[model samples]
Target: MRTCPHPFASLVLLITLSAAAQPPTSPLGPVSPTTGLVLRDDAVRALIQESSGDRIHDGVQRLALIARDTQSGYTEAAAWTKTAAEAAGLQDVRLEPMKDGPQWRATRGELWVAGAHRYRVTSYADLPMSLAAGSGAFEGADVELVDVGTGTQEAEYAGKDLKGKVALTRGPPVAALRNAVVKRGAVGVVSSYSTPPWNLSHRMDGDFPDQVGWGLVPRSLSTPGVPAPFLFMISDRQGRELLAQLRAGPVKVDVSIATQTDTGHLSIVSGVIPGTRAGEELVLTAHLDHYKPGADDNASGSATLLELVRTYTTLIRRGVLPPPVRTLRVLWLPEFEGTREWFSLHGEEPVRRVAQFNFDMLGASLTRAHSRFQVSYTPDWNGSFVNAVSESTLAFMNRFNSVVYPPRKDFRIGSVTGSQDPMDAHMERYGRGSDHQLFNDHGIPGVAFSTWPDDGYHTSGDRPENVDPTQLHRAAFAGLASITVAAWAEGAGALELARLVALHGVRRVAEDEFRARRDLTSVPVAELPETYRLTRAAVRIAYQREREALRSCLSLGAPAAPVQAMAKALESAEAQALGRLEVDGKARGASLREASPSAAERQARTFVPRRVKGQELASFDELARKAAPEQQPRVAAVQAAITAAETALRERGEGELRFYQLPDALASYADGKRSVADIRDAAYAEYGHVFPVDALVELFGLLEQGGVMTRIR
Candidate 1:
């Protein structure tokens, strides 16, 4: 018997059996006939019916009134959230302080052309986004405006003298500021960046003539040698006018910026609704920081979470819903940085957390924003039954709302004025953009509920009016229902979850096999064996994920009998799947031995590889300095590739590219127990063919050269 970490695990089987014998008569609802699980229809109805769209809209409007990144704004919002939670009868409501570096505030900003064309460009008093975040204080000074296309590459400034001038670029303000101000000695920077619409399915206008976003100049670039400069963001329309003026004649601008940075703490608001079990928790989180009028980006998410908290607490207080078996904790904080600080302060508190449900941009109007409500799963490597649970809940809500409130000509809900149409919710693959990444990085299963393709994202135009209350309600309903089921699940619920994992695993394995077969045409004949190995390994990984999902039920204190039965069933299922594959391989004149590597082929497995934390290859020169004298040429080639990857990532506004083009299966084999030859064989076993041996060598070599990993001798 496996020792359970949870103290309540011992009582789970007893409570589950007792509950099953005597069904509660009150608000606990009925027991599922098929799976013997408890179904709280009353709780589900309260979550759906009690959720107020109007209340959510009001919350968004109130929060959108101030830029929440500022100290005063953050404190006010935190206080308001705490008061709201307390008013809803939630327990342990508090304002937790996070140790963020500093608070940045923009007070004043102005830019005006003085030579040949006397006209004002933009002002912070008129638009906060025009000032850009992290800009330092500067007085009015007339400087020539130099148009450097993109302003990121050194070639952009080949013959241009940027000293004492303001460089204008089409890239983002942060990138342009780094290149022109810190690197080229420019006094300031101006950026005109826009995200173009790729779809006309919803038929919304794509032109954003006045949209501007936040920017940052790292403190590292603000040293005495390289002074950080005041950066300004303008719309594409304003950029075109300035560029045209520059082309006609010499144009100089008078610029003045007043911004301040001081030591400050980030405010994180948290509240809990206690459950029957102790220590077990499910966290619901949303970011509370953004520019003023950041409605769809995050205010919508915060409002939705608040509404859920209100609805849940109200139902529990009224005795219409029973308390869950696991605690429900809600958190409102700054984005990634704030989450990191919270984790640092809490230490191992996260170990008690079973799952995280993150809300971000969940209230966009589908027709206006060209958005789709998505429940994005955690990546395959972190697969769990939570994915199926969330997906099923969203699908159920989508169907329920369509029948109850069909889309009218005005797109209003039934008898509700100004409300939008029903939600067009769908499942999406894994994506990394919000605070959920922080939770997932700490081994917590985190999922995101968001709306994508919002035109007002990170822009001055994102206001409360653009948010759809009906969409917010639907998202809240889905999130509430999914998490409630997980929090209150018992023996029967665990069995149901196990079944879903098995089905999902089978489907995933079939999809992997299909993809591998399709990729065979692209593989070289010599590498076919490696490809076959990789494909098999993928199937094995799918089975293992299913097993892990089933085992996780043990954490919920499920009965040993049912849990063991499910494990045995899974073993048989995996055997049947593998047996079919083996039979197919035999008919094709191939054998299992051809796919699996011999013992002699395996390298020594005693050496362990450890990854170096917080180390990055910042530049080609840094890579050369780290590499040995004889390895400079190879390091230089890899450095060039990394540089190009970084450039591409910047242009696309995406994350870093540490393992670009490397298969997850291959990467997973890099654990200390596996040697380089073992990893190669594993890759072939899973992917249906091996990658070039030289390619694997180069990858490990680059990792060593870049200070990311070191081999234990």
Candidate 2:
């Protein structure tokens, strides 16, 4: 028997008992100061208690049985989700069909190695990820297996004959196909690209094989010169065995794949909980597509969303929770491609979306999955008060649980799952892997609630058993609380959000100041002026970004009074933060100049950067084609940097390189109204500390040369 550590636990228990004994009421009480909405700790506690991890497990178990795509499996999963939403008592539950490009469906696939030692490699019937999505049908044929280590690089295949043979690699399936099959004429590929916390082999007890999530052989590569090859994913242990056989002597593999491809509709399951305001909406979304047994990758997210719908509907129907002022919309998409199709079909309707919350891989057990929940926000340019609200809600939950449960390592008395520790979560910056990227691309402020470092992510090992019910409840609670606050926030709530933005602004400025000061040491005394100019530009842009965030609150119908109050608060905070910089400057024996526009600003004011008419978004190829002979080398360098960074991002499965790319940032900020200098300043504010000025200049120069941007005087 465990004893409560604090008197607060007894108080909390008394409160819980008292609340449980009382009857449900409309508009649940205890309004939060941060969100200007009723938090209803009692209701939240009840919902959490009622939440079934077993239900989540069951849902994941069902979804994980098939690979959800445009095939029959996808249709089945969509129907099931729609039914689940309907069963949850959600209104207007329906499957929205999206017309998309070619849909690849694996009907059958098999691989067997028959050289040095005979062994079966994989079977699609057993593990869908083994076949690597998009593989075309092929008759069983024996071919020599040649080892191409990390087959993504050309150097890796130098002096090796890959013709009429199978390329074996430790690289990703996609990369191996591109390098070995498309370029070198390999008939097939065997890859073993493991998930992150790469030290899993050292940490975990056995030889664990990882799933190759999905692989694609582009149509463009299937021309007369390059034949699309069948790609098979094998475990690291199996791949090692093949490599050992190859080192000892020649190894041969027999491969066969039978797949179906056709123009099909990607299913999107969606429904709405109507609010008083007709058009305003808060979207709760999660992708429902992945390899078979992709429990953590997306089944968890889908289950969590369903549970949220159930909880919200139950509470609203029972009159224990008030319907939001703005409608709450739920979407289960087939990952990125499906999201893109949905947006294309809806077109401008996204403009009415106030906020979007995406759930992906959210049910990982802290102990079993080796994961932690992360509340990731939009970029600084797209920042809103939502970040503050969500972070604060999560912080409050952590504090509340700490007091109520006390400290215990094994488990909590009332906790439904194994772990006894309080919910551990932290705020994360912008990331670009899931469906949220599409929303953010369309100017809708979106956040992703997910867990990271799961060894079984995108692998066969990600089963229903790895998901913790308590974590599911916690995730559902955090997501619900944030959405509810955003949906119901009135003028006062909007004002609170503004205050948070101001606070965020203060922190951003302080961080920039600290970074700028630290950077000063790395530069020569003669270069201080340039560095100072850049730092000042960053500070001004930071304030402008905050101002933009506060202004966006108006879109949510926040009253003028609150907006004005926010402005005043932001002004005070900015002044105080800048004041400290001056003191620090004096102490460092350097006279810091007041934040002001630089010579670049003056030059930029003379010209506006406008988008070219009827031109597509700039790509590396377009930039190269548009560059002059002399500028081609510099253009190539920029392209190389971006490609290398993206490749590193894919291989590591960690870091913010995906979000920090300068080309995308420049493209996003380069509107006709903003000058070149303004765009540069905004980029500096967002990512200037990490990227050098020369690199930025070159990227902007390429964009200008590529006609993606034209300077009009």
Candidate 3:
């Protein structure tokens, strides 16, 4: 490693330059570039240098060889993690059992186009994802291949003879199974569906034509007497070739699959380093389970987690860093189900959880994936100092990892064995669909680091070769640094955190107010009143969350003076922003007077909905099955609304809430204290979308009707 004789001066100057770019009162997040929190300069630099991309890359390569898909592969991966954690000097490393999850493992599978000549498309031996999980056993069954585009709707299957034939569709495999196999007696399905393209710039098939996607047919979708349908996922190019052959002549396809299903427990691997504080903890989490060869989708994250354990433990043992004040725990688990189970265990220990950092899909090569590394800050409703810490770390990584013009000798933060690729990293607003959601839903704030426009996510192209070592090194450095700063927070460090929270709060308020102004300016006069109400709710709700974030500093043993001073400054900033919003509204011919809630909103205020323990809605399919007969139509309607909203948002390529995420957002606020009106308001503030009160009221009513929830009078 090269020596930077005076790097601290360069580090400080970088922060000063970044702050100067913004207003003095609202600097981005933290004072120092590294770790965001106030900590020893020497320790921060050492942590950065200690992160090894080669070590992380080796771990990723090893883990990618395991078919870790929440079953046999997941169990095997858990054992490996347990042993590795112990070797890294972590205490109390164990594999915890999460019970009652569906389990299935592939034995042998292959798909071939058969006739006078045989052409093998794929096999489980070559790509495990080619054989969808939960597929039934079949032996060399030859069936006619029918081309039913999408294969999800009756229209797609119209006038097609699918009986005992294998259906080929570019839609979800599960949906194809339900509509074509279960309902219409198809033998199986060959799907080529990948995640929808992000935009015109990032088309999955155009970029990675040979990528075979991962798919599954859930056991719940099985018919009573009918055999379970097997599904095979082929690449888009292969699928298109099959379609062309079908147009020319009748096509015969041979499919074989052998799988076993058992009711077994999912696994969670947890490793901890004890601290002076007993129950208070900071957790670093990454899902260790995905398909085989899933390097960037999750193996990268899990590998980086292992590296953090090794680096931190080694540093503390070598007397290079101080022992943490709070307990630090690292978790590798199956994505959603395992996360929920982990939180359910320990009798809901959310109050003791100070913060969490989540890593997922962190090793993409910028040039290969055309993706950017994103730090998704905590949701607005559960605001905390963690967001500030994350923002600061992100800024540091962006500046240090990228090539600066007239590169200075004083600034050196590069891995020796890793590529010195300029990083495309920045902060993103709250995003869903990762292990971090469970923590946020439990009222504990967390942040997720990920790469977006992942070209091969859930596809065969997410192989070890697709991962970049430099990206892994940068992510590990930033992630470990963020957690370390929080773990060691005390008097002076806590004070700095307090100031950072206030500084970040002012910037957020400004951003929110600016968005609201744009919305108000565009609204038609007829809809101005309703739009103005939403705008007011958005800005005020944001200010309240900022206050809550400031208050969170007291838990870090921060002195009352800094906390109070920052709170006052936060108040002043919000007040100024609100005044500007008022002027904008008045100029647009909207009244600034406080307006009462509409009848629907007022009625919503009366019902305080609480989720039934252990019965919260987990998926839309589960809700459809569990809802009462009369409520089925309503549940379907609500789900349809969510889908429509999600499509609209995605088509426009903006907003934070995905259709699938709306339920969790609503559930996060349903703590028996917030009225339906309050939940609606919070949702509006968080995503800038006004969910209809009728839709929310109907959804909860159906849940209550199904014994999944109870509404207080």
Candidate 4:
């Protein structure tokens, strides 16, 4: 969790992993050092204070305070935030003003909208909608209105004339609607949707397209904004029903949306506490807009960021904070729009780089009231930042929950990199959801934090009581810690920083590389070819073939019985080797000597990555000759298996398994007799197995239970 920046969960695979420091004394730490400095920065503290805001805890006091403050357009909350920062002795703190666009906003009681309508209306209830918008061609004008739904399928309007009439469509990809109306020569367009305020819909940046010359009419009908005949949008259930009825009666709506129609106001916030190295930038951020108060919605995140700035400023003032390797830029935005402005203006990738840690919710506990602390992350081939960050976050969580806060594993941290590798796909899931949206959109390795299924995410229920100070403190700390790690790695040596990540953050769930490869295959063959840096000797390189082959055998839930048998054997062999092995002599293998693999086979199957003699296969003809070597009657089952084995080898080749150059696909661990599991253990980590085709498939569904590969999908 990043305080100046960045949520919670529950059965985690608690590996009993150790952290550098002993657990803290309380979950409510005034601070915890993530990278170098303390975690719970002032911004987080202020937010916690703000959550328990300076007013009576009564409903009227809160609403009255909100109502008294006018935050429309330039007269926004951001404007006041500047005054507050300055009052606190902060310098260079300014609100990043947002663009208001070409649309106009009407004042109270003014006739902001007035338009000619073939369908007349007195109130919202009388306005016609379905026939006026949903219908492709109504009342047969010279040109027909092309009714587009969502506009995702452009092929829907192959040969239609949409000249002069309205192009009524559905939802906002505002740019798309603008293009359609301008291209098709419609007078205007009306898009529709019936979603809630926080639905996200994966389509919000509503920036209208250029190269089009048409006015726009958005029939948004969602929870946030209303249709103004303004270029923007609107929604209402009862009114929509009445409008639908009137339209069914053949009424047409040509309502004016803009008399002076436009958004009320919008702006993004960016604050920087200059690091020693300003040329390199580390952007920490969160969004600050919701239909309501949005405490956990985002006020929590933005407020936390402010606290970080405050903490750093205090540290700098006291000269206690170390000069950073990179400049720290904390940004607060109105979701996508803030990021859009930054990218639209300054899209260049930061030359002096660390990583981006965006914290969205990050401060709520007990949606179920029994869930553990959670950490979500993103990974990259460039050593995957997400893996390390989550590891770090969980380390903090465990310390807080287990040691500091007392005996409870209630707080747990994890990164999204586990089941869904956003680094491979769906960075948008995290990136687009918050201020990081633009960062990822710009191709930076970034990760954002927010609570999952937050009960009061966007609704009125999203008040300050929902926030957890303990969680907020952890988030602030985690964000700073990961950023520092990334910066330290960039400024110093990458491997050193990476080692800290490996140690404090991310788990090498399965080491021997071979076993880990299985986790990859369970995902998809297409994914296996994707590169992940590995070390033959402490250096990283992407060798997809060997990785993929290992992945395939491990991926199969359970390969054929022969393969499972082989894997079990390999497991046995490694147990034996590891028993005699001692780096610091930690792993206890002496007690299970009988459980070890065969001595000869175990020695042969050492971690050499090349097949040794004795277990080696000759040419197919030679193998056939040996299979029938002077036997009175070769068993039919044995003969059939031999043929299958040859075919299996051929199939593996198609999948890029160069088995002939290596050893036979591990069939069993050396159970004093060498099996496949033993071979894998010998090859990699503890308690391992690698099933080629048969046994691998069976294991896929089973391994998930043990947090091996939770689910292939």
RMSD for each model, in Å, please?
Answer: 9.0, 7.3, 6.9, 20.3
lDDT of 2 by residue, 1-713 (tens): 99757998889999999987675453323345433334555655555555566667678778888777436888888899999999997889888888756778877789988755567788988777788666767775568889999887778889999877888888766777778877778888887766533334323422465434345566655665433578787777788878897888888777777886788777889898888778788888999887777887798899888888887788776656667778888899888767777777675563388888999998788777778888876776676767766776667666555544555322221245435545668777676667776677666889889887676776667887787766776777788777766777656555555655566556655776676556554555555655655666666555666777777777766677767776667667666655654454455565445345556456555556665643323444556665678997788777766556545544545454244434664566655677666666565566543343344456666777776767665
Which ranges in model 1 have alpha carbons more than 4 Å from their true place? 1-39, 115-117, 196-207, 225-227, 401-423, 503-506, 516-526, 582-713
Scored by TM-score, the top model is 3
Question: Mind giving the per-residue lDDT tens digits that candidate 1 earns over 94-203?
Answer: 88877656678777889999865478889988877677677777776568999998776788889988888999987756667777887778888888765422222222
Ranking 2 against 4 by lDDT, winner:
2
Off by over 4 Å in 3: 1-30, 33-37, 100-102, 196-207, 349-351, 404-412, 590-597, 613-621, 655-659
Each candidate structure's TM-score, on Cα atoms with residue i matched to residue i, is 0.81, 0.83, 0.90, 0.45
Candidate 3, position 480, lDDT: 75
Provide the global lDDT of candidate 3 against the true structure.
Answer: 0.78
lDDT of each: 0.68, 0.69, 0.78, 0.39
> Model 3 TM-score?
0.90
lDDT, candidate 4, at 695: 30
In angstroms, the error of model 2 at 42 is 3.8
- In candidate 2, the residue pairs with backbone N, CA or C atoms under 3 Å apart (3 or more residues apart, or in different chains) clash, namely none
Sorted by lDDT (best first), the order is 3, 2, 1, 4
| C-alpha lDDT (0 to 100) for residue 279 of candidate 4 | 67
Task: Give the true-structure RMSD of model 4.
Answer: 20.3
List, residue by residue over 1-713, the lDDT tens digit for candidate 3.
99776888999999988865652111112466543445455666677777787788888998999999847788888898889889888889988888875578778898988987888988998888888887887776568999889876788988988888899998778788888888888888999887653332365353566888788888777777766889998888888999899999999888878877778887889978887777789888999989998999899999899889899888877666656878888899888877877877854554388998999999887778777788887887788888877777776666655773315322345555666678657777776788787778667789998877677777888888878887888788778767876887766677778887787777888888888899888878777777777787788888888888878888888898868877887677777877887788889765655567778777788989887777543544566677668777788777776676666666667633343466655666777888888888777777667777877887777767766778886
